[model samples]
Every structure is written in C-alpha cells, then in structure tokens.
Target: MSETSELLSGLALGAFRLNGQFLQIAEGLARPAGITPAWWQVLGAVLREPLPVAGIARVMGMTRQGVQRIADLLVERGLAEYRPNPAHRRAKLLQPTAAGREAIAKIAPGHQELADRLVGELGLDQARQCLEALHRLSAALDHFTDHP
Candidate 1:
C-alpha cells in the first residue's frame, strides 16, 4: 500500500478508538444525572431551542428514526415535550423540559472540570487547532462521499 493509504488507515483506526473512548466518557458524565449518554446527547441537541425531529437528527448526527425513539422516550419520561409546529403540522418541535435542563445542569460542572483538565494538558491553542483540523477532515470526507 502507498504511504498515503497507510496513513489514512491509521486515521480511520484512530477515529474508531477515539469514538469508543469518547462514548465511555460521555456515559460516565451522564450517569450521575440518571440518563444514558445517548439520552444526554439527544437532550443536549434540543436544549438550545425547539427543533423538529428531522432537525434534531441532523444536528445530533443521529438517524431520524433513532432520534424519534429517543424523543418519544424523553417525552414519556417528562424530560422533553413535542409542541405543535407552525411550519409543519405533522412534524412537531421537540424541546427540553425543565427536568431535562436540570439533568444537564447536574452534569455540567463535571464536564467543565474535565474540559479544564484537558486544556491544562493540551493547551487551548493546540486544542483549537486539533478541532479545526478535525472539522476540515470531516468536511473533506463528506465532500468526497457526496461527489462519489
């Protein structure tokens, strides 16, 4: 294999490894609030404002059906609610309820502490550069997939 192909393979492996570690961290951060990381992710997506099911799915990098299932659960558990959407009658908007906000608040301090520690280790500029590179890489992959 070419050097570029070998490097790309390494990048793919790194992404898979990072994804697992990230999910594990999310799981721990969310547990104290009595929510799974997936639930926390769904709620976090809607915390800023109400969004339709499809919108939430797009923003949260989740499947529409998966988000719908979680949204239903959130409503059933009193963490979220579906309000009638003026734009689309059938597609109601999902928003975080007071309980949802409270749950997220419970996790915020720990999340911030972790972030602070990471910043101490990595430095703010280095972290921002890494984030920018990741975004660029994601966009490049997206472009290639779309074109292909």
Candidate 2:
C-alpha cells in the first residue's frame, strides 16, 4: 500500500478504537447518575443554552432523527423540556430541566477524575497536543467532505 493510504488507515482505526473507549468510559460515568451515555451527551449539548433538535444534531454530529428520539425521551423523563424558539415557530428549543442539571452534576466528579488520570498518563503537554491534532484532523475531514 502507499504510505499515505497506510497512514489514513491507521488514523481511522485509531480513532474508531478511541471512540469506543470513550463511550465505554462515558457509560460508566453516566450510569451512576441515572442516565445513559446518549442521554448525557444530549444533555451536555444544551447545558449552555437551549437549542432545537436539529441544532443539537448538527452540533453533535448525530442524525436528526436520532437526536429527536432522544430529545423526546428526555422530555418524557422530565430531564428536559421544549420551549418556544424566537427564531422558529415550529422548531422549539430543548433545554435541560433542574433534574437534568442535577444528573449531570452527579457525573462531574467521576468525569474530572477520569480526565485527571488521562492527563496524568499522557502528560499535560502531550494531551494538549493530541487534542489540537484531533481538532485539525476533524476540520480537514469536514473541509474535504464539504468540498467533495
């Protein structure tokens, strides 16, 4: 195989493995808080401000249908609620309820501990570099996909 082809394969494989690892860790952290990883993810997306399901899907790199299903479930479970959107009449914004914030708060200690451990293992400088490299790779892939 060509060198570039080999590098691309390696990067893809490594990312896939890392994604699985993070999901597993998220499951562990979120389980104790009475929420699944998917719930935690959707809730996290709206912690700063409410957003429509389509907006959350775009920000999360998830399918709109998938996010919509999760959002509906969150509302039913009393973790979140839909509020009127000033910009769009039909597409209401999703915001976390007080219960949702409490659940997320429950995961914070475990999240911080895991983060500290990972940073210690990788070293702060290397961790920052790894994050920057991943951001660059994601941006390049997004650009390529957009242009293509």
Candidate 3:
C-alpha cells in the first residue's frame, strides 16, 4: 500500500478504537444515572447554559430533529426543561433541571479519574500534543458533508 493509503487506514482504525473506548467509558459513567451516553452528552452541553435545539444540534453536529427528540426525552425524564426563547418565538431554549446537574455532577469525578489515568499513562505533555493534533484533524474533516 502507498503511504497515503496506509495513513487513511490507520486513521479509520484509530477513530473506531477511540469511539469504542469513549462509548465504553461513557456507558459505565451513565449507567448509574439511568441515561445513555448520548443523553449524557446532550445534558452536559446544556449544563453550563441554555441553548435552543438548533444551537445544540449545531454544537453536537447532529440534526435538529435528533436533538429535539433527545431534548423531549430529557424533559420527560425531568432532566431538562424547555423555556420560551425570546430570540426565536418558534424555538424553545433547553436548560438542565436540578436533577440533570446532579446526575452530571455525580458522574464527573469518575470521568475525571479515568481521564487522569489516561493522561498519566501518556504523560501530560504528550497527551496535550496528541489532543491538539486530533483537534486539527477534526477541523479538517468537518469540511466534508455526509450527503453532499
């Protein structure tokens, strides 16, 4: 195989491995809260501030419909609330409920501990460089549209 082909293959495999690891860790962390990893991600995004469904969808790189479904579920579960959006009358702002904050707070320490372990294994400086490279790669890939 050519060098470029090998590089692409490696990138694909690395992405799969990293995604699997992330899902595993997230599942473990979210199980106690009776939420899925995806739910945790949505809740975590709104934990800091309220955002409209479209805004959350953009931040998460998800379709607005998908985020709306998750938001509805969160609201039904008492983990989130939908408030009127002054900026857009048709859109509602999503905010985490007290329960949502508590759920995230409970899971955060374990998540941090796992991250600390990984950082320690990689050495902090090396981990930082690796993350920086990944961020650049993500930016480059973000230009591609899935259906266009």
Candidate 4:
C-alpha cells in the first residue's frame, strides 16, 4: 500500500477504537445520573442554549430522525421541553428541563474525575496537543468533504 493509504487506515482504525472507548466511559458516567450515553450526548448539545432537533443532531453527530425520537422521549420523561422556534414554526427548539439539568449536574463530578485521570495519564501538554490534532484533523476532513 502507499504510505498515505497506510496512514489513513491507521488514523481511521485509531479513531474508531477511540470512539468506542469514549462511548464506554460516557456510559459509565451517565448511568449513575439516570441517563444513557445517547441521552447525555443530546442533552449536552443543548446545555448552553435551546436548539432544534436538527441542530442537536448535527451537534451530536446523529441523524435528525434519531434526535427527534430522543427529544420526544425526553419530553415524555419530563427531562426536556419543546418551545416554539422563532426561525421555523414546525421545527420547535428543544431545551433541557430543570430535572434534566440536575441529572447532568449529577454527572459532573464523575466526569471531572475521569477527565483528570485521563489528563494525568496523558500529561497536560500531551492532552492539549492531542485535542488540537483531533480538531485539525476534523477540520481537514470537513474541508475535503465539502470541496469534493
């Protein structure tokens, strides 16, 4: 194989494995908060402000339909609510309820602990470099995908 092909394969495999590892850690951290990893992910996307289901899906790297289903479930469970969107009538914005925020609050300590542990293992400089590299890689992929 060409060197570039081999490098791309290695990067892909590493990313897949890292994704699984992060999901496992998220599951563990979210379980005690009475939410699943997927739920936590959706909620985390809108923590700062309300968003339409499609926006949440984009932020969470999920499909709009999948985010819609989760948003409906969250509403049913009293964890979130739908508000009329100013931009679009049919597409309502989703925001976490007080209960939802509280649940996420419950996960913070564990999340921090895990973050600290990982940072310690990686060292602060290395962790920052790793994050920067990932960001650059993602941006490059986005650029290529959009252009191609």
Best by lDDT: 2
lDDT of 2 by residue, 49-137 (tens): 99999999988888999999999999999999999999999999999999999999999999999999999999999999999999999
Runs in model 1 lying further than 4 Å from the true structure: 145-148
Candidate 4's displacement at residue 121, Å, is 1.0
Per-model lDDT: 0.92, 0.96, 0.90, 0.93
* lDDT tens readout by residue for model 1, 1-148: 9999999999899999988998999999999999999899999998888999899887776899999999999999999999999999999999999999999999999999999998899999999998998899888787776588
TM-score of 2: 0.96
User: TM-scores, in order shown?
Assistant: 0.93, 0.96, 0.90, 0.95
In candidate 2, position 7 carries an lDDT of 99
RMSD of each: 1.4, 1.0, 1.9, 1.2
Question: What stretches of model 4 exceed 4 Å from their correct place?
Answer: none
Backbone clashes for every candidate come to 0, 0, 0, 0
Most TM-score-accurate candidate:
2
Supply the global lDDT for candidate 1. Answer: 0.92
- Better lDDT candidate (1, 2): 2
Which regions of candidate 3 fall more than 4 Å away from where they truly are?
Answer: 146-148
Off by over 4 Å in 2: none
Q: Of 1 and 3, which scores higher on lDDT? A: 1
Across 60-98, the per-residue lDDT of candidate 4 in tens digits comes to 668999999999999999999999999999999999999
